[model samples]
Target: MLDNKLTYVVGANIKDEKLRDYLKYTENLSGRFIKSSGLTGKIRVNNNVAKLNHRISSDDVIDIDMKTDEHQNIEPEKMEIDVAYEDIDLIIINKRPGIVVHPTHGYPSGTLANGVLYYFKEKNEKCIVRLVSRLDMDTSGLIIIAKNQYSHMALARDMQSKDVSSKESNDKDLNNKIFEKSYIAVAHGNMENKSGTIDLPIGNPNQDSARREVCDEGQRSITHYEVIKSFKNADLLKVTLETGRTHQIRVHLSHIGHPLYGDSLYGTVESEYIDRQALHAYKLIIPHPRTGEQLTVESNLPEDINNLISKLKSEA
Candidate 1:
């Protein structure tokens, strides 16, 4: 097993006994000559420090080196990106389907992050490409990027759940300050109403597939969807998100029996164009962190989806 050594004193609130607890919590860091030095600048920590409440003061130095089993951390390749709008605050890209947002387990490189990094490097802009939110690899749509850490943190704080107006009363400033996210989804079947809201809770399906499902005990999720186009076997939809969750739209719709056409995990695939799920992040409304202005952005349907719709229409 590889080893990484690290050192750090407990934060101010932590008690003396909790210092060991903090060390044990952090992964990686193992050494033989581990000495617990009194409050010093940038003390080193070892692997076996997992405790809480270790009394540490401000400006305490922390150093840790932990073992990381060699996972594929490869260089990212370049690709084309649909630049919708860009400014110092953020950037919006017309994200496409079948592309992972960031490098992860299965995909270590050639992700959207790689492409965005390349874009910034080409322009010689020394800015960090941070994602405020992410869309799944298979789901295509707009993704918001923050140019710096301040914008990222501010937008993230505003994205937290806030009290929404029930009467549509005044409070316009507060309304615009909070992030309002929206999307468009096409379900496999028609619904009872042309437009309706689903107030359901979402939870991880208690199964081995690692998929999400709708459960009463899960976090509260709300999806507002409207029927866009009706087909013989399927219907195009415009789904707006009142609350964001992992697989929120897909799980909620599948629970109501209107699973998406190309979704294999939640719903069974039943058509020739069924390769990936038919979901897209069509619209996004966010509050400007610096200016506090409202910004709405959207992405059009990709060509493959547009052609699939045309073919489905022709077959019918």
Candidate 2:
């Protein structure tokens, strides 16, 4: 079970409301979380054990446990994982390309989540592993794993605050942003300028649709890129995403005539420098969930990308 607890103050408008109604409507608690806490007898009202149907007053204090009930079927597997940082609240790991983050179709084992689960089990920690951000299977880089619900909610809210496409809240409150993620990539052609921003819109299509596209009806997507090193045939770039959308970097780069090297899904021609896409999430900056201090985590380029860079430099 996680150490973090969900607490809320009952408002006057929700006076005399049932405990379940207060949790569901007033505090916006998840049904799954409530159910799990109910089974474990962790739900409380005014520091007294209360049932879901208990009536709460206007000034009542509700405290709910944040433990999660997940991965009922998935078992932990011990695999080598590159840990970048670890604390009581969260962990940052360098994920390799070609391996999915979590268990998905055709890959139920050997995933990063499975490895993390084993790590937690070895440490004798009883908490659910929560991924704050996701990277594509072919995209390698630093990723965050929250140890509790509070940290997960903080990091997830930070990501959503930076997202210009989120209609849930106003984007003017930039001070609330607590995380910054950057990437390093090798694209097909030499960039036109040293740095520029791509402010396009991304559209999510139906489930049967193959891919997202730049369209008028799409949400606002922004990506800023700077040419780091120019090679004979390719350019190494440092890309900072102002808004995270699915395939934003790849799509924006491809739209500007510089598809990522070895990106078969979005590139015009095949690449010999690398087999998988040359995109790496090199840097991740986030505030500590408990302390509110800035934490910067980074990872070096993998062997294949490093060797490709060396080959390009030698040729240059």
Candidate 3:
């Protein structure tokens, strides 16, 4: 367990501003975050709970409790993790397959969160774990974790903007954009189209086999794909997401009759080469929350996928 309270100092410029405005200006907290925290009684002033409309003054101490979910209190475990990048604000990790991103049913520990917590403990930094995005347990790739609430807020807002048309729209402001994620995958079939876009609506399907499908009532999802290399019976694709949804790449590719290799849930064929879906988050471009500078990080293909590709080439 970790302490969640965050304290802020009122500067000279915003001396008499309302608590809400002060938070927005100094901490980059959003109105939605403020309201959500208010509902949970997470915001306080000088140890007393405060409202969004409460006026703030110079030298007045503001205490805020970071919001957390039910599983945040999980004990840390000393598991090995491949760290790609780390700064005061966030950490980028090259997650391996078979490791769950967070704790869930049948898996209460040995998660990425637990490993990250232990890593932080070793460094003597007591901070709550905050994941910016998640990859499926069987999918290996680059994922980010924020060190504090401020960075989390910025990244979360950027991700949300892709779904809704807000003031933080990418067209309106490029610097405030969240992240652009790129992936590489080995699909089951030889795709006819070398490059194309999948503009389809995805929603819950009636079938028990799949949680989502392309339907009329589904949300609009878009995936851009380009074939990188053609193998004997498969194609390696460089896939990008215009709109991120649950299993967007898997669902979209599967809908096109070319599912990911070894993806039992979506692919028609069972691959003997790999145990899980051959999808890897290869690259990510994120703007720094504080500096607004674009930061690009890349993750290499894991050994399993590399070996599979080598086998395909040798047989070709």
- What are the Cα lDDT values of the candidates? 0.67, 0.82, 0.83
Q: What is the lDDT of residue 219 in candidate 2?
A: 81
Expressed as tens digits, the lDDT of each residue in 1-316 for candidate 2 is: 3346767778777667788877765554456656767777888988988888899888898887765554535578888889999877899989999888889888888888888999888987776669998898889999999987667766776677677766523644434646788999999879879899999998866556746777888888999999999998799999999888888899889888999988987887676778888999999988776556789999999998998899889998
lDDT score, candidate 3:
0.83
Report the Cα RMSD per candidate.
11.0, 4.1, 4.9
Q: Estimate, for each residue in 1-316, the C-alpha lDDT of model 1 and write its tens digit.
A: 2123233444565444434344444311212212222222223434333223444344454554322222223353579999877876678898989988888888878898888877876886665567888988889888988775446655765665332312222335344465666776667777888889999888876766669877877887888888878887677888877667888888989999999867887887645485778787777777875566778877788766777678668866
Off by over 4 Å in 2: 1-71, 168-174, 204-210
TM-score of 1: 0.70
Worst 10 residues of 1 by lDDT: 27-36
Instruction: State candidate 3's TM-score.
Output: 0.80
Better of 2 and 3 by lDDT: 3
lDDT of 1 at 163: 25
CA error at residue 298 for candidate 3, angstroms? 0.6
Worst 10 residues of 2 by lDDT: 168-177
